[model samples]
Target: MIQAFYLPNVAQIKKRYENNVQTLLKYPFLFRKDFPDFDSLSVQYFPFDDNGYIPFYKNENRFGSYINVNDPVIDRYFFKNLDKPILASDVYSQYQLEYLNDNVRKSEWVGQENHIYLHYTNWCNFCNFLSCLNFKQLLPDKKIVFLFEEEISRYPIDFKKEFGIDYSQYQVKPIGIREVNRLIWHTQLAAHNGGDFFNEIFYDHPNLLVFKSVMFKNIKEIVKNLRRQWKQRGKLSSRLETELARLRHPTDKDFLVALFLNNACACCDNFRFKNSKLQPYSEQYSERKKRKKRSTQKRNDGISR
Candidate 1:
């Protein structure tokens, strides 16, 4: 049984780290009441640190160890002295198993084999651009499914109105982190802009198709080429290949840090190289300024006429 402990002041905690609860919500199966082992497993709510770490406790015997979810130093110390620290990514996989077991009998839309799961959360501009590349004309034979981070109604514009493609015609579903974990199991191929969620879920998946922007006119062709190269060489020729390699054999906590730095820009910056080495952000800033100046000059000249 696994027990997670958090501060009792829920509103205050949620306001501080908005995504914290969202992350924890993925483990609902641990608290299920109907399971035969439910009595053995339980979660307790307590008035603990309101501004500090969320704690986790596991009790197999009379004694249990305390783990601070937010403390990296503690996590490292534990790993070095005791056992490999249970990472958020580790829990992510566990959540998937629990979800699959619970829903195995149900007729929910679990992905199919060789299916392409596009992680379009609608939160990142780059992800949105990648999703747009999955035009119907590109992959007529493949089964393409889109996983959204939020409900369709929350989106400001419909895909039909904005991109001229009716998303309803395709399999588009809003999913939480747990559902995403379950979906990844059935997905043989995936296309994403290197979001953290995707990075964690598909870290071990061998056939991942990562793209930065809409550089090619045909998304399907590009994915096919990448998959071919990946199968032959065990890696892609893209800039993200190095980062992707590190993800495959993630050894320590640095993997998550690397993913964060690598995925810093959802669409714009090629973080694969930038995050690995020292570079000047000012250079990119200056280039943007120059482009803005040129655009402004053209606009001013047009207005003067």
Candidate 2:
């Protein structure tokens, strides 16, 4: 059925989202985040989807993290192609999808296991809220991060190609805002206290960070991006790293990123992947937490009287 499903083409994407949203509404408990309006698709809009906090699940299964889908979004926008609509809004989703596709090469649009494709405006909120799923429920310690910025529109494709493949991972970018550097500094500070996920701010101001903070959050360029992450992790103000170093692994998931990120700037506090390798975060749990989880497992192990 998955393969038989026609990947939502330019003409079909709107219907898919509308149907999907309708389907989601039947089960409010499942997706607590706001369903993305067909209008919000093109570019990031502040506070709309800051990171996915609406809800529409039947029983209870919030949509997990967001990965930037590939580049057709950009193509559609250029052609003025749009996904269908629920009530005829601005078609933001179509525009955003096109914006992201235009931002990255064709190869990177496919999904990767762990990564959150953030958009600068409302889309960022959408992705941010998606983080709550305990997506690591199946794969423990999965690493992911919010990819954003509003300046990618400056360099465009030729500029990104020079940066290489990893650059493709960054989709969902913003167009431009002259005050980005200062804005990001504040954003990072606000998100820092929420939890471990937001603890690590990629102070990475890539040439592209100029895009929306959701899509183009990479370092200056590929080469510099890597260097900055490694060499500069410690150089950020001590206040930034101080609280981060103290994060206790989930006293209870109540404080988890999935639960509370949307309350503020949106967050991805506990990432599972690092440097292209997946890290098993489950291992970092305390003995008590492990025992608690094991006890729940035992209960689920199925031996009811």
Candidate 3:
């Protein structure tokens, strides 16, 4: 879960902030979820004086990675409360505001009659949606749709072309048919970290049959598929679930590697790691040549003797 506190409150912020100028300072991208100890991280706003909070500058490292604000009120708040306070200004990028305004608030589409929105806030989620799309999950009477975040253009993938949207057109908008009650949108908010959509978009949906493509959710599906395949092949281990549960602080990569290994094992009757012979063919060949040369030299020396 992500906890964010903005002075003037996010709802009260002006429209310009909603526009999310690339150079402008926005809310921080909290990795607090990444750290269990800092699960309830908050970005409270406190100013040094009544002149309103001084505008902060960009970190230049990456969009919304971190911010450096010099305010006495904020400093004091951090000093007394948490050792390292992540101020609202510190973790903001244009993406944060974009998510808030374009996706969450401008969601008038959510209120439409007989509609189910299949929203993909980033490229990874979009790809996941495409791969795991099951028409049976959607209501036949209701329209099915897709949503994409505009920043998806940054990825090399031709998403617009995929859905028959104009390739040149770029913006956060819905793009899907409405034969009954379905819609699609490109609400590009969370970029590299697609998981953040679970926190940002999932909680507040009202009367809206909203579904965001989540990587972990897809992983669960992949696990089930692999489990069935392995079980069918008589390779399902009783201890497999236990082994997965034993992983401490496992990442998406870890789960993926496990899935891949299980699938490979099921596909191949003789799947085993030969670490000793895992080297590249070129390297192994060179080693063999070196050994042959050494043997030849020893034989030549013996002949001379």
Candidate 4:
């Protein structure tokens, strides 16, 4: 059975996201209808953060943003720990089970719902994808459907090539947030890579299985490592604040550190830090275009010769 867990403490979270949270809280009251109970579980790359801070947040560009890591040593540290493959059993452990059990007991989902929805963003990594496989294994009898952001349709990863998962098995629809809410009622279990919609969904639906991926245990130490590095850097730049502002909500002294590490390790973007600032993707794209043009010109010259 999928399990529900405690929602993150957003008491001090920013107003930008808090508005959605408030709206979600009023959902059941407004509808005043009997919502079916399903075993709901939310999953992400890392285990869910119990302390209330979500690792992923929206950027000004509305893309998966990464924290700038000026130190090569620290950058390499995150890549080694986060970019590796993870096993299902390693994550679905006693600790997670306990949280799920406790939450499920308090939830309204009385455990009869059978539909499972797997939601992820365009920037999800192999580990996030691995969780979907784990869920299918855990609940084979349920009707499972994968719902991804429309942008995922353009993602270049080959599921079959990398993990032996047939594209046909995905059964995904490129959808938006509205579509997700429309289908949420039918979803007995909901798992998503921590997305912005989490603000509206996490506590709004009780008794359903919903989980937000936080960070993994193996990489927690990076939080300390990055804190020291950033502390030494003195003041944070405006660009970095795009992420740091949201992370500051958690009371942990360097709570933002763990979140920074989370964004730095995202699988989708090849993020780089320059002069202690995060590089924009537009620049990266322009560079790629120039390189392609240069390569094409070289090939034509060689042919003429």
- Which ranges in model 3 have alpha carbons more than 4 Å from their true place? 1-6, 9-225, 229-241, 245-256, 262-305
Candidate 2 lDDT, 259-303, residue by residue in tens: 122212112223222221212223444354558778988898776
lDDT of 1 at 296: 95
lDDT of 4 by residue, 36-148 (tens): 11111122222234222212322322323222211122111111221211111122132332222222211012112212223344323322223222232222222222334
Clashing pairs in 4: 9-52, 37-109, 40-209, 41-209, 41-210, 42-210, 42-211, 108-207, 109-207
- lDDT digits (tens) for residues 94-173 of candidate 1: 22223323322111232112222233333232221221121323233323233344432322333356546453233312
lDDT of each residue in 1-305, candidate 3, tens digit only: 01333434434332222222211112122111121111121221222233233222223222232222222222322112221111122212223322222222111232212112333454332221221122222222223233345532323323345534342232222211111121343354557666555534532322132334434446677765654554343344444444545666544444445554344333421222221111112355556656978999999999999
lDDT of each: 0.31, 0.31, 0.32, 0.31
lDDT for residue 93 in candidate 3, whole number 0-100 = 25
- Residue 232, model 1, lDDT: 50
Each model's TM-score, in the order given?
Answer: 0.21, 0.17, 0.16, 0.21
What candidate 2 gets wrong by more than 4 Å, as runs, is 1-73, 76-283, 286-293, 302-305
Displacement of the residue 113 alpha carbon in candidate 1, Å: 41
Question: Candidate 4: lDDT over CA atoms?
Answer: 0.31
